[model samples]
Target chain A: MSDTETLTRLSTADADGESVTLTVNGERHALRLAPWVTLLDLLRERLHLTGTKKGCDHGQCGACTVLVDGVRMNSCLQLAVMRDGCEITTVEGLAEGGRLHPVQEAFIEQDAFQCGYCTPGQICSAVGLIREGHAHTAEEIRELMSGNLCRCGAYTNIVAAIEQAMGEQAMGEQPAARGDGR
Target chain B: MNRFGYSRAGDVAGAVRERAANGAAAFIAGGTNLVDLMKENVARPERLIDVTRLPLRGIEEREGGLRLGALATNAEVAYDERVRARYPLLSSAILAGASPQLRNAATTGGNLLQRTRCYYFYDTATPCNKREPGSGCPAREGVNRIHAILGTSEHCIAVHPSDMCVAMAALDATVRVTGEGGERAIPFAEFHRLPGDTPEIDTNLGRDELVTAVDLPAESFPTHYTYLKLRDRLSYAFALVSVAVAMELDGGTIREARLALGGVAHKPWRDREAEALLRGQAPSPELFARVSDATLRDARGFGGNDFKIGLARQAIRRALSQAAAGTPQSQTDKRVQ
Candidate 1:
């Protein structure tokens, strides 16, 4: 596509015509965004970070969830420009080069996906949720993850993956026995 | 999503000044509700004044009670030590709202100022007096399962959608605001207006005024408090019916009571009649039923929301009972801080 065509594709024909520079998954891109151009659109259209999915487009569905400044937010309900200078980590950023993050590995091992469309957002949101320290128990996990929907009914496996990841972190921080001395 | 310009204001004064300078500028905090509306084109502010970095983000002990800053998240207010210990009802109300993640992002001021979750208000295709005056209210005749039953008008019937505000209303909370005219306080009951004539004027706030904090009063009502919410789902959704009640019990007899109804009116409703009737009466299912009747006497329902009136009554009864139980505070409740 030509530069003009690219610009036209990136621009949302809406009321508040604004421009935004977004850094997503460690890449910076500038584009003209409408007041209505959601972070979900910026990720999939402008930056081509297609890992985030659009479910309800409302905050009800967490399918478009991303970590904005290490906190999970529904990207579909967010404006791209509204997140200026904020660090956004999407599902595409979960793996470093070839190694999967432990949460992603656990999700795969626990078979935490069925259709897998909601899996990317689910995993990204889970990572964000755990970092926020909300993965305390099954009930808390269920309550925290209620925003993300898995239509395939893989909630049981998803919870297991999150718990397994939390357990690993707990084991890694055992304090190394204070009495024994370093 | 609609395209719009954005601006970041340095402080509360700067934000309010920007809104005054530009008629279409909206102060954005947390972006929990405003962003959703922007995406749906329900709200099309030309310029957004980001208020997240403003100094309005603390919960302080005031001379009378607690002063919660506008930018204080719902989670912060709910988990604050003073709020939990002195005002358990406020904590319960916040928890009864959307899930933990959403509560973390929703601010106290935003929670009070949030627009109704009426289906008509959300759907741009539908005509709503709240969205567009003279556009008409389809909720009056169409599917109205979640519409208001009390304090409604011919133009609109959508209920105020915050459980926190309901509790605040019962607590006689005051909203501190700063605008072109300077600082002033508004009682929580008077903060939100009824849909009566001008449904568009949700609050008495001037266009330039920014809510800085919510000031609660220090009152020893010797009250048992509870917030009861009825929703389609157990979590992550707005209330269909809710009640926030605080009552003083004297040997199982009601000495005084403060009752507020949610999902029932244009604003969080304080049922004065119910409050009056409950006083000097024994706390019983029968007395609750009578007070509930007094509260819903003039409740005019549309097509599908007549059921909410009864559900709201039941919720009120349950909340009152829980408060009267006088259960000792649990260990987890302390851990919330």
Candidate 2:
């Protein structure tokens, strides 16, 4: 997006006059935001990044989940001013050069999502889950992913996709496949 | 959705001073609760004092006992080896709450300071005395299934919404606070206040004060600890009725007992009467029943929550019996040690 468009979206004047410069998807943007404006609204309305959805507005729903410094947090529960100078990776930033992230690819391969409204949040949340090294066992995965609610009941497939992704990543680190059946 | 100003605090004292300067300033920690409240228009602060970067993050074995920093996340507190070993009840309580993502975002101090999960309190349309003073508590006349039965007054019935706090009360924990007058230690039992005439005041904390840490006292009790929570759903749902109990059994008799209940009170309801009844008494089904009965003496439930009193008593009984049965001696005898 252009700088003029970004400035046009953040039209509201700061009541207390404080400037917040935050990094979004490798782009640094400065905006004057109120202390009360949440990160969810800032990303969606200000930056025009509609990948993040607002489900409950409360922290009970994981629909507004995003990675703040590679850690998953409810964007609705965080103020935009609190994220100043913090590295925020949203669902829009997951893919690199038109290539899908491994978790996104696995999700598609395993048919892990049904009603895809929660898929972006789930994918972002899953990336954070793997980054935090919380997918050791099915129980641990279930516990870690408990925050991201999938109303479609696609949990079995989601867990399978994460497991597959972890396995593939592990295999990529090893030597190339050999023909030896031993 | 109202606009509010923001500022960053250099330290605890600076935050307190900022709060004091800004009449309606609120301290923002993990932003797990405060920001949500702001969006709902339930909490309106003119200025938000960010103290997340302050050096208030540590879990140390102190002289008196365990000192848990206010910024210590729920995940950190629950998974800390020292906390898991020394205060297993506390660890268990933290793990039993919310979920991994929430626990990761939630801080110990934030958990303690979180407002009641009472549905009426959240809905601005409803008349909640806790939210708006003299608005009249709608839960009193409306659906009060999850409201408090203990530590409640005629004005309010909202139950305290933390599971970890229940265990802390049983452990006799102390909360360290820093404000205008410097540092002060408040007993956990006194940290949270019963809803007497002023149900709006959930705690004894001053408006400018910030909770720096929670101190768990070192008590010598070879007790079996248990935290039992009964809820409608398996996860995420707050407890319908919960009990945190620690009992030291001598042979078949109870040597010492500590009991605190959640989802039934404005604070962690410690049943000293039940403790007195169980001390030096034989551990039996009848004794457990008696101990449980004594805990709910003044319980006056609303229309929807009439069954909670019975549910809580039964939960306490079952927890006590299970705790007594799961003693080390029983484990040793079963393993032929």
Candidate 3:
């Protein structure tokens, strides 16, 4: 086949699209997108919920971390079409009506961010970490939260904020943790 | 990434049908490695059959052993009480791998099928025999510090990038898979293949086969097991040379032993002869040294990875000593620099 024929064939092959419904941040959204669109792009571009940052489009950096069914995952690695009918909680869903989530508040209190680009993913991941019940000590928190990279060297404060949030959750001072109690 | 048709498989038969219908179709679960490769244009599937929602997420006891469903997430398996209690080496190996978020999204089957992290394979501009067969392997003579030292071929030198599979190889696990031909059980040692003339073939599974679960035999190394991983960083880095040692000791003598090494081969390197040599022998530094030397006897490094031969030797000794002492590394433990 000629180059033009090959290009035409590829374009026609790529035209396959799918419609999906996602329950995002307590709201429902119906969208028609290509199958290759990642969950990160769907949140930032289609839904216009730009709170979740995209550092690396691959799974290397955790800037695109989000809670899928209350479990933290790298949204960049998840295809939007595959996540249909699933509940997604991005960084935008962490706060209540004009009130910051405990993890978000702790991030501020502990000065957990410098450039603030990775703050949203960090806070959301911290909330998921607390719900997972894995981070008991500061070192364990650091090891568990290693996915969300903060290039500004705010790891010390990030661990502190997660620990503080865990303390509040244990004391029942914060609202009930997110997710379906998995 | 190239566009692809998406279809969710409702069952194992549905997944197998979708995969067998079109040779270009791919089964996607967890999408951790596949999505990355797609973005790099290393893999371009015309159809993606999502199998995440399939009823293969069970982690139950079967025939006095444990059966882990294909869709069971890495975090679920690593944090499982039964897995930690009975197979602590598997738990340690899983936790020592990727970060918490990636582990939450990555599944057991996906982890087994993860591709190599070779620089040339990801760069479409370069020649990679694994990515494009017969294209010539640039990594054979290029910067190959992360390449394989054992079970390598002239066509490819990329090492398999998985810490979990190393432990599975040591645990003597069995992989349960379903294909158009029907269901079959594959020994974990035979699941992954070494780089031969056909560098493109990674595993023994057929093109249309779907892994259902991994079964662990009813055996426990309660008192002696260790997964020692040496990496460039303390967290979120691939292994430089990792060793998984699981042995059952009676007082000071080794009753049974299983040894495997990662980051130094195309597949998990298992030394059955070396393991058998340790049987009924008393645990001592000199005995560990002899075993390590025997394991690395035929290891040959290209250029940049000559240090791995010595590094793997030391790691074998350290891991054996730790396992013998009943102080296996845990998630909370710091790097043993």
Per-residue alpha-carbon lDDT of candidate 1 for residues B86-196, written as tens digits (9 for 90 to 100): 988888788777755567678888898899888899999988898899899888889899888888888888888888898899889999999988999998989999998
Correct interface contacts retained, every candidate: 0.39, 0.56, 0.87
Q: Candidate 3 regions off by >4 Å?
A: A1-16, A174-182
Instruction: Compose the digit string of candidate 3's lDDT tens values, residues B1-337.
Output: 7767788898899899889989999999999999999988999999999999999998999998899999999999998999989999999999999989999989999999999999999999998999999999998789999989898999999999999999999999999999999999999999999989988889999999999999999996766999999888788999989999999998878999988999999899998888888999999999999999999999999898888999999999999988998988765675552
Angstrom error of the Cα, residue A154, model 2: value is 2.1
Task: Put down candidate 3 lDDT per residue, A1-182, tens digits, no spaces.
Answer: 23364335434433455778899999998876677778887787667899998898788878899999999999988988898889999988988998988889888777889999998888878888898987899888988888989999899888877777787878777544332211
Q: What is the lDDT, from 0 to 100, of the residue A94 in candidate 3?
A: 86
Specify the CAPRI tier of model 2.
acceptable
Where does model 2 exceed 4 Å of error?
A: A1-9, A14-17, A96-98, A169-182, B220-223, B249-253, B327-337
* Collision pairs in model 2: none
lDDT of 1 by residue, A25-122 (tens): 78876656655556777787767778888777767778888888777777876766667778889988878988888788778778889999899888
Q: What DockQ, on C-alphas, does every prediction get?
A: 0.31, 0.37, 0.51
When sorted by DockQ, best at the front, the candidate numbers are 3, 2, 1
* Model 2 chain B worst lDDT window (10 residues): B328-337
TM-score of each model, paired residue for residue = 0.87, 0.90, 0.95
Error of 2 at B163 (Å): 1.1
